[model samples]
Target: MAKFPIDFLWGGATSASQYEGGHNEGGRGLSHMDFIRRIEKSDKDKVFPINVTKKMFDDHKTHENEYNFPFRRGSDFYHRYKEDIALLAEMGFKTFRLSISWSRLFPTGLEKTPCEEGVQFYHNVFQECRKYDIEPLVTMIHYDIPVYLTESMNGWEDPKMIELFVHYTKFLIDEYKDEVKYWITFNEINMIMNSSYLGGGMFVECSDKPAETCIHQALHHQLIASALTVKYFHENSKDGLVGNMIARLQNYPYTCSSKDVLATQQQNQFNYFPTDIQVKGYYPASILNYYRKNNIDIDWYPNYEEILKEGTVDFASISYYHTAVISSEPDKQEPIGAFIRNLENPYNEITSWGWGIDPTGLRITLNDMTDRYGVPIFIVENGLAAHDQITKDLKIHDEYRIEYIKAHLRAIKEAIGDGCDVMGYTSWGCIDLVSCGDAQMTKRYGYVYVDADDKGNGTYKRYPKDSFYWYRNVIKDNGADI
Candidate 1:
């Protein structure tokens, strides 16, 4: 087996909203994620509802049900960081990719001073990682925006959010400059186009402006905020590497027809436009054409061009879960709740959640990203979400998870061999936590299992699964043992 680089960071990725359970502790205020409740739906209905309306928000806010909100209490990582970091250290994690809760620090987006207790909580978490000699890759803002921002100004739709987000980023960089060296400005930034409610906290039904107008305007504000944050981090922090995170959903032509190929190209362009602007520090001509064709006008400031140029990211980071197929045919059966319409691929196996398993897609994405932008690429999020069964003996076999990871790792190694400047791979949800898709706990994606269920009934005890030992060995051998 080909050995990985000695300094390759082998670790896992997690977000604060999905893992941390102390929603009300340490002076934490409600976030947009806190306002979102997991709705009951049939298996036919997608795991998460993509189209959120103002009516749904209104009903959910006043609803009498208590358990509708699943993320209110995540896997309890807030109180279990010590135990979790110990497990990560045992697995030989060289780095741990996690996000800082923006709401935790500035309870409300307009706060001039941060919550001291909330600041101390993250300080303690970073201290724990230091004790284990694990490098922390902290994301400045995940999907958890301050609920007050959305309620008051309709999230990023208002240009004022750019200033507020920059303030929050400055505070974090100033306080944690010594502890965190790797920073990501946003999580899946392009999702703002498709999942505006969850990604940008913009409620379309509540906005007086057109939905498309609001979405694009919010996206512009976020882009500005991201660039400003990157520029500030490099200027203030010592030796900090700031990057942009995007959902690297690779698209394949469903058929050999030219139309299918064109469709795939267009879809891929939409996915890459955000990263292109962030990395290249300017809008691509294709994106400008797209805006004109759609009649979407962004509110650009006088210094916006210079801001982007100065704020270009040092590297590019992506979250790769599954690949999608695109076809030009109008009658294609579209996947439910997918950001892009996808045709079923006959060559790949489907997961329980209707995602296609394509390890080679990982290599394709890595190569494509490297070829487009000559910067180090990081696989910040990649893992399988399956129905893991724990036997009566209190052990989870999970050979399937090991197999999934091994195939992906082999694909990554091939990408490295193909001259892709890959940085490291961080498997998503290294420890069991709340699922972002369905907000369910049963969708397990961790090597270490947590005793929790969808209804939040469990001791929250952490246990090492069979894949845990296998991963430890793989790390011990530096990715050669697998």
Candidate 2:
């Protein structure tokens, strides 16, 4: 096995809504994620409506007390940061990736000044990271927008949101510039096309206009917002860098057919579109023609393209959990949500979530990215979510997860040995937090297990899973053991 670089980062990735509790505490206003409760509002894009709408968001807020919003009480990390950080430090983490909650800072996204309590809360978190010699990689925004902005400002649809986002993130840059260096503009910038609501806080399905029209318009604003945030990060912070991120949903052809290959190419092109814009600092011709073919005309400033060109990101990060198989034959496909009707990859293992486990795909994706962009790449999110079993001895023998991550790491090592400039890997949901997609806790994806359940019931205590110790040795050996 190839050894990792001495400066290679070994850490974990987490988002505020999925990891930090205290959703309503410290003067925090509700975000779109806070009101995400189960509703059977299925669309062609999904088997069930995993994404919420403005109405569903509002309704859930009205009936907030009637349900257990797992996101609101995410591992109670807002209170358990010290303990969790200690655990991660014990695991020999060199870096820690987390998001600063947008609503937590601005409350309603209209505040002239950030809630000092919210600001201080992050200060404390980053201070803890510093104590452990852990570099903090802060994501400016996750798949969350303040409920107030989404409701009143119509979220990213209104051009005003770009300014607001710029303002909000500018404050974050100024406040945390000294503590944080690597900042990600958005969690998944391209997600608006697939998950309009969670990606941009736009109720695209329920909008008065065409769904594509609304989505494209909102995405236009988000792109500009992202670009502007990158420009500001460069200007405000001396040693800081802003990077682009997306869910790297790599697809393989189901068969050796031209139709299947073409379909896969199109899907991969769309998947790479946003990052391409962020990295190259302009929209590609293919995506422009795609929008035209789809009859999607996004409204944007004439100069927005120049803004994107001026504010290209420093690096790029991706969250790759699994791969999908795309087939042109309809009968061969099965719906896996997000408007994707995919086929099974016989060569890959399957997760409980029905996602294809393709370790080799990660290496291929890494090499492709290196060749295409020629910039440093980081695997900010990758992990297996499995049903865990806690033994009578109270030890979680998550050998499956260990194997899953080990295989993925070996693939990463192969990519590195193949001369791909891969920077680091941060296992997603490093400490068990609420799962975002399913809004449940049972989809365990952490080295350390959280003693919590779907309804937010449990001791809320932390226990090291079997992967924790295994990963500690892997890090201690710096990829030599893997």
Candidate 3:
């Protein structure tokens, strides 16, 4: 049988904001994610951005941390990255993917002088990974943006955000370029389709500017930010690969009908068009037509064409979750089901969160991305999140998780066999951390399980589950025998 390339990296990924508890550690201040979690748990039925009642903060009857799920002081990776890296090393991982908290590096989000403590913290973390022979892959911005920036400037909607992000990124490159090799401009930059607040989508929502105008403006800023990041790092740094990540949620026609096919096409267009402009150096005609139909014309600045031409990425990075179904229906206008057809896939087992478990979707994503853009694709995040149970033997017998990963690996192998230019694999949330979309500890996806309760109370112990060993061997064998 064919095998995973000898140099193929096999490792797990986690983000600073998710796993690195010490939420208040390393000079890292509370981010928008903190506020987001606070409101979501207190009153489940309340629409987001509702008033944070004094009762919400002071109510002793509610869970500690004023939120139901555990986030602040998660697995305590700030204190235990060494041990975690050791565990990953034992698993034969060649690479480790993580994100640098913007707040950690720039405590207030706009600070000119970098925080010494935050810089020192990641410095130690990277140094430890280097010692263990694991190549460090860093993402500049994960889901956590500085709350100060969000509240004061309304997040990425402000053009100032592009500059701030670039400044923060430059600091990271100057500090760690000699050590770290792989970098992504923003994690899932295209997730504006889901919630604008999370992925520069709020830039449009909270703008005094027209909604379409702000969206296009935000897109321009993000594209410029990503391109500028690549241009600067490539020219200035010693050597590194820079790309933007799309949470590449693949989709299929619900049926073979023309409408279904059209739905998938439109849905993929919505998800991919913005990033395509960044990676391919120009917006597709279809996307321009999309904006025109909506009465939204993006303002293109002078020298914009030149910047894109000179600064397109060297690669495309993606996080493949599960594929969705798209059905064409013009009249549907609810917030969740409005844009695309995210119908249930009867063929696969779904998690409690209702995300389907279709490994084949991953392979399909790689193939489609390669065929469309003709650039190397990186699987930055892929995995299963489920409600895990710890057995009496003090082990998380997550065989189901192992099976989920194995099936996805198999799909990846098939994609490789079909000659897709694949780079590497880094499953999301390598060590159990808070979920980005759900903000729950119970939605656990980690090789080494952290002994923490959903209510945010536990010794914060780490235990290697069965999949941990399974993945170790998979990496060791290079996916030939998995």
Candidate 4:
């Protein structure tokens, strides 16, 4: 018997800034993503691709063609939505996770109304998804903030962003209330703890206060925005559901020692900080104590708790990629994720890019999250990034991807049998697109291959990999054979 429920969504995930081109069309304004240049392959290790500042963006505007902005020329989804949706339909997708570009609609973060052309684009896209019974799982904002917000107010640092973000959320809910039933408020909302720019749209160099201070304050405002998003989404859409997204950095203790275990426990709490606020409708005391001891004061609204309590989310979505080990010994720490510096898992084989290849981590994560939150858990982003090669017949024989996904799916099945409420799964980068880390298209995590290079140069044709047929069968049988 299949472990997955009949309504379980089997699909692929994508973000607008990572794949949707035509950033300048349909009255779309420049986003913060539009300003960042692609990192050269040789510079990927030394230079941070997203640690951007106001000065960097300003420089890019002045010297336009001197740099390569690969994201500006994405997989051309903006023009090929119909064709892409058809391919997904052919793969037997039940849901399609995608994001809307904020700047594409509002132009600037200050806009009271949206651009009609931009609104129409989504209408057609969502309608197409429905054409094949593919439910559109929409993310309202996925790392794409209008540059005007950062230029004027340093993005999320200012409390005024709450109002602006809430305004945008209302427009999306009111406009696509019927079209998009599943909405995610933000992508990886907790990443702000480390990456002030990508997570919070905060240019640290331009901030009036220290970066840490700005981040804590900005986090408060974003939490409020999410709560308000849930509030508005519930009131507006009778059947629509809202969710909170987190980048789940599942960490393990390096040793069985008490000190290592305690450190790992503390690290897990910090990793789950944002999810607790959104799901439990309140902050835990440990966080409060940390704030007090660190003197990280936030300007909380008078009715903040009330809003959080009332607007708790319907489900929790997370992006779980790899497992990083945490040790009490500081000297043993290395780079884990973009934001976290920690020890790597010694037991797991690692990817070429250093991500630990532990399919078992998914099972552990689902069980932990379910035990903690008692909410429906959606694996919104999960995939293996591999160097896929094309054979002589122009076929991509990605057996490694198949093996990776099969192991992960088995883990999901085990978690479900263990009584974890696993709602759905959407593998990340289903169609080859630019990697968020270095803007490289070569680091593929897709079942469908794109004939594009790192610099966005190619015919832009899409072909199904071997894993595509494998996934199609998995979805067809609802993982009965996994």
- Runs in model 2 deviating more than 4 A are 38-49, 330-340
Candidate 1 to native Cα RMSD, angstroms = 1.8
What TM-score goes with each of the models? 0.97, 0.96, 0.91, 0.97
lDDT to native, each model: 0.86, 0.85, 0.75, 0.86
lDDT of 3 by residue, 171-269 (tens): 888889988998888887766545556666254444677865675677677788777788898888767888778777677777798977876787778
The sequence of per-residue lDDT tens digits that candidate 4 reaches over residues 1-482 is 43888888999999999899898899999888887787666522533336677777779889887988878877889999999999999999999999999998999988888999999999999999999999999999998889899788889998898999999989999888889988899999988776788778878777776767788888888999999889888887899778999988788889998988888788788888889999999988878877798777777876999999988999999998887777777687543234444356778987767678888888999999999999999999999888899877889999989998999999999999989887799999999888888878888999999999987778999989999999999999999988
Lowest-lDDT window of 10 residues in candidate 4? Answer: 334-343
Instruction: Return whichever of 1 and 2 wins on lDDT.
Output: 1
RMSD per model, one decimal: 1.8, 2.4, 3.7, 1.8
Q: What is the TM-score (0 to 1) of candidate 4?
A: 0.97
Full-model lDDT, candidate 4: 0.86
By the TM-score metric, which is better: model 2 or model 3? 2
* Candidate 2 clashing pairs, residues 3+ apart or interchain: none
- Please report how far candidate 3 places residue 141 from its true position, in Å: 0.5
| lDDT tens digits, residue span 1-482, model 2 | 46678889899999998999898799999998887874322111223225676677777878878977888888899999999999999999998999989999998888889999999999999999999999998999998889888788768878999888999999999998999978898997777767777788877766667987898788888889989888888887899878989888888888899998988888888889888999998888988998798788777666997899988998899999878888877777543224343466789877777777889999999999999899999999999988888888889998999899999999999999988887789999999988877677888899998998888779999999989999999989898978
